[model samples]
Target: MKKTGLFYGVNTKKTAQIGKQIQEAFGTDQVDIVPIEEAWKTDFEHYDNLIVGASTWFDGELPTYWDELIPELVSLDLSGKKVAIFGLGDQAGYPDNFVDGVGILADAFELAGATLVGFTSTEGYDFNKSRAVRNNQFLGLVLDLENQSDLTAKRIAAWVKQLKKEWAE
Candidate 1:
């Protein structure tokens, strides 16, 4: 069986949704969701395959908790671990080169010694610019990439499946 892990940007229903999909895809409890803020940061290397996500803030920075958590992750040894990344972002309307918190999380993951499998963006579904987002509702700018509604979860689930396929080799 594949030992899977999930980390979220912050505390939100979106993170919970991401957790549910991980549980389902990995077969009931085969997966674990750790808030990058709450996790020990160093526990990531304990798993074989790691999937992580982040919700974007106005400046495209990781949430406060995730911000403090990066250094810990950067200190781990993940040399050959399978990794997948997902992020929540909205269009900056500038040059379209923005992808929310994607880059922030990717950089940390790479520095931590893991090799990323791939990535995707929800694209154009930004909520940080309005009160609607402050109200804690969801905008579909991003997708689950799976049948679920959370793009982060969908991406993680897909990544886990891909790792399984790779391991069989």
Candidate 2:
């Protein structure tokens, strides 16, 4: 069976918590939860599927650790790998740049030739603008933990279901 890896960059623990939620929803021992600090040592080729999580910083930047890991991520041969992304951001606070960190990661993965999956609809979210949105869709799952914490679990569950379908295909 192909293994799954969940890697995350955390600051306020919201991203970490979302990673944990995904780990639980996947319900498989083959899944590995790795912090961005240690993800540099991870063998990207070992996992057939990768789920990356990050919390957006001011002005739509990725968390510091994710920014640091980008070089290593870019150095990997991720072609044919299934990659998914998730991000935590404060839409109420940063309406102009909500969850843009996910877009940065998505771009990096795309550049590495990974097959990015799990793009989510931007229907219910209220944000003025975001790099994460393209053609009225988020690059991946996006959580507004500061303003919409109540929807996190449901959104995660739905996204995980979508991922399962995508990975199986």
Candidate 3:
């Protein structure tokens, strides 16, 4: 199997920790954990499969690292690439816009011509609204580390399992 590029913001403690957990779950050899700060347009060109992660900031904005890199990322011709997205948010604190960062990244990657995968159901969440939701499903996996930390590992495992199957198709 080709190794996946797991790109995330290194400065984001929670997102970084979650990225590490994901890498461990997939086995370190199967994934490359790259800090978004160090990723270039050419770096994305190295892998056809990618796992991108983000942490939602105040008012449902993406963290600076992700926000800054998006323009550069979208500039690439990602026609044949497959991208999956994951995000961390405080559902209880930001119920109005839970996990909007995932949606933002989804749009950016779509604009870049990548095939987005890992659409997940929004069951068991207490959010009032989100940009991440489309056709009644989240554009990607959503994890609430603040209110639902206990479910993180299980969610990641299930999502990774799902991604493996989806990518295979």
Candidate 4:
């Protein structure tokens, strides 16, 4: 299997922590954590499989670094790449726009021609609205570290397992 690049914003502690957990779950040999702070277009183009994550900012906006990288990311031709997104949000605090960063990133990757994977059910979340949801399922893994911190590990493990299967196909 090709090594997966796990890219995330290093400034956000929670998102970075979650990225680390994902790397550990896949084992360092199979996953590499790349800080979005230091990432270049080549980083996105180099990996066939990628796990990218971000934290949702106020009013459902993506973090600063991710927001700034949007144009560059959209310009890429990721025709055969596989991307799985994960986001950190406070559902109880931002119910109206829970996990919007995931949706935003998902859209950028889709526009770049990546085959997105790891769509998860939106069953247990309590939110009024979210762009991340489509057909009643989340675009990717959604972790509410504020309201659902206990479930983070389990969710990451399950998502990684799902990615392994999806990437195989």
Candidate 5:
């Protein structure tokens, strides 16, 4: 009943909050959100489940930091690793750019030999949903890795229950 590893690819403040929420909700004391810019090969190996997040720049353009980090990521052999990708963007401003960064992570994670867990999608809450998401705005949709530790924690708690159910079968 111990949650093992989780990693993030963003250096933004949101990443820390999301990481903390995951740790608290899943009851996993061992959780670290490493910035992709400062990531090392050893970082990839130590994690069982990796949660990667990044922000869109230049009106949905890819941030160089995450892009630069990607080349290094594919070199790792994440055979048994599970991946969850989240992206930050303004869907209203850059509708076309929504969730594009996700594919990059998914493709690279696949190349590095990892399986995606839960769901994989982008979450541009700031502009997409007016900074206030009602109901399950992005839960099974864009895959919200959002603020709101209380709500986020609750959703993750349910996901954990579902996760165990899936594994049990």
Candidate 6:
């Protein structure tokens, strides 16, 4: 059995809702969800899979907790860990920096040697720019609850299915 850990930082609770939905989809017994405020207490090395999430803040910055968490992430060796990411952003409000926080987290994990999974297609999303975009795809699942709340459930369902397959590989 693979143990999974989910860590997230949220502002308007939308990101937290998304995290909860993902947790439900993955099964409560399989995932341990931790808010970013308490993430330092989590033992990342204990999980076989990791899911990190955050809402993009002003000017493409990561959420507050992530600012503190980044250093800890850098010090850990995550080689061979299966990591996935999710982020919330308002494309209409911050078109140029949409979901950039997800990219930031992804980069940190990559630097720590984690194998990031769940790259999502950029189709159906309206945004001028995002650091999360690499090769025309989001480095992870990107949700725009401010602009597209209706799509969240379906998107999460598909992403969770994708992650399950990726984890199996």
Clash number for each model: 5, 0, 0, 0, 0, 0
Lowest lDDT sum, 10 consecutive residues, model 2, at 34-43
TM value for model 2: 0.94
Q: Judging by TM-score against the true structure, name the best candidate.
A: 4
Worst window of 10 by summed lDDT in candidate 6 = 34-43
- Candidate order, TM-score descending: 4, 3, 6, 2, 1, 5
Error of 1 at 89 (Å): 1.9
User: lDDT for model 2, on a 0 to 1 scale?
Assistant: 0.86
Q: Which regions in candidate 5 have their CA more than 4 angstroms from the true location?
A: 1-3, 120-169
lDDT of 2 by residue, 90-161 (tens): 888999999999889999998888999999999888889998988889999999888889999999999999
Give me the candidate number with maximum lDDT.
4
Model 5 agreement with the true structure over 25-143: per-residue lDDT tens digits: 65655556566667788888887666666555654445677777778889889997766555554455555555456556667888999876555222424343322122433322133
lDDT of 2 at 85: 95
For model 4, how does the per-residue alpha-carbon lDDT over 1-169 read when each residue is reduced to its tens digit? 7768999988888998898999998888898888998899999998999999999999999989999999999999999999999999998999999999999999999999998899999999999999899999999999999999999999989998999999999
How does candidate 6 score on lDDT? 0.89
Which has the better lDDT: candidate 3, or candidate 6?
3
The true-versus-predicted C-alpha distance at residue 152 of model 2, in Å, is 0.7
lDDT (0-100) at residue 88 of candidate 6? 89
How far residue 11's Cα lies from its native spot in candidate 2, in Å, is 6.3
TM-score of candidate 3 versus the correct structure, residues matched by position: 0.97
Compare candidates 3 and 5 on lDDT and give the better one: 3
Superposing all C-alpha atoms, what RMSD in Å does each candidate have to the true structure?
A: 7.6, 1.4, 0.8, 0.7, 5.9, 1.4
Candidate 6 regions off by >4 Å?
Answer: 10-12
User: In candidate 3, what are the lDDT values of residues 96-146, reduced to their tens digit?
Assistant: 999999999999999999999999999999989999999999988899988
In Å, residue 83's CA in model 5 sits off its true spot by 1.3
Order of models, best lDDT first: 4, 3, 6, 2, 1, 5
